[model samples]
Structures are given as C-alpha cells and as structure tokens.
Target: MSGKYIIMFKDSATPEQIQKYAQDVSSNGGAVHQVYDASIKGFSASIPDAYFQQLQSSLTDSPIAVIEPDGVVTTQ
Candidate 1:
C-alpha cells in the first residue's frame, strides 16, 4: 500500500538523526512532497507510510506523524 504521511520529528533529536531521516525517506521509495517548519519544535514531511513507524521509533519522545492511507488526506 503506497501513501503519504507527515512525520513530525522530536525536538530533542540530534542532527545525525535528522540527516538519517532525510536519507531514509529517499532510499525507502518515498519522497518529501511537503515540508513545514513554522515552529522550532520540528518540521513536517510528506512521505510514505512505510517510513512512518521507523520515524516514530527514531524519536526519543512522543513525536507524531500524520498517516494518510492511499486516497485519504488531511490538513493541519
């Protein structure tokens, strides 16, 4: 199942973590369709659902990622 998801990484994360995420998204058959960094907390990325969980695990806190199924989408 291919789809779009918004990943909001944890603020406490290190630079290396963020870099890994950017790299992961590309190699995992996912592209960053959108990115929003209005707040210092973190940024959001539109990618694939496959990478969502990995992102969640990569965070040390309760970082959230918007998961939208194939044809489903929602805005913040």
Candidate 2:
C-alpha cells in the first residue's frame, strides 16, 4: 500500500535539515522523486504505508511541517 507523498518542512527549516530528511526517506525504503528547496522547502517521495505512522512519530521533534499524499490534478 505504498504511495507517493509530499513532505513539507516548516518555514524555519534549514537546508541541512532538509537534506537530512531526504536521506532519512531513502534509508527508510522510500524513493525521493524531487526536492523543492527554493519556494517550497520540501520533497516528493514514495513512502511505504507501514512506515508512515512511524515516520510521523519519529519526526515529532523535527522541522517537518506536514506530510500529505501526492494526488493528481485534473482540468475540466
């Protein structure tokens, strides 16, 4: 039940912290697709469902702002 997701960092998150978060994702069996460091201090990755809750809990003291599922948009 793994799915693509976006991990956003807080406004005060430093570049080094962002880098560390990305590495954490990789080490946790997640695939980092893209990193948005300019306007959005965050990254897009695919994380396992089983690890989602654990990741959130582990980042309780981190700069993680939010974790959201990456969804496709449609134009009508």
RMSD of 2: 1.7
Residue 22 alpha-carbon offset, candidate 1, angstroms: 1.8
**Total clashes in model 2, counting residue pairs 3 or more apart in sequence or in different chains:** 0
lDDT of 1 by residue, 9-64 (tens): 55565556655666677788776654545563333445555566666565554444
lDDT of each: 0.55, 0.87
Model 2: residues with Cα > 4 Å off, grouped in runs: none
Off by over 4 Å in 1: 40-76
Best by lDDT: 2
What TM-score, computed on C-alpha atoms, does each candidate reach? 0.51, 0.85
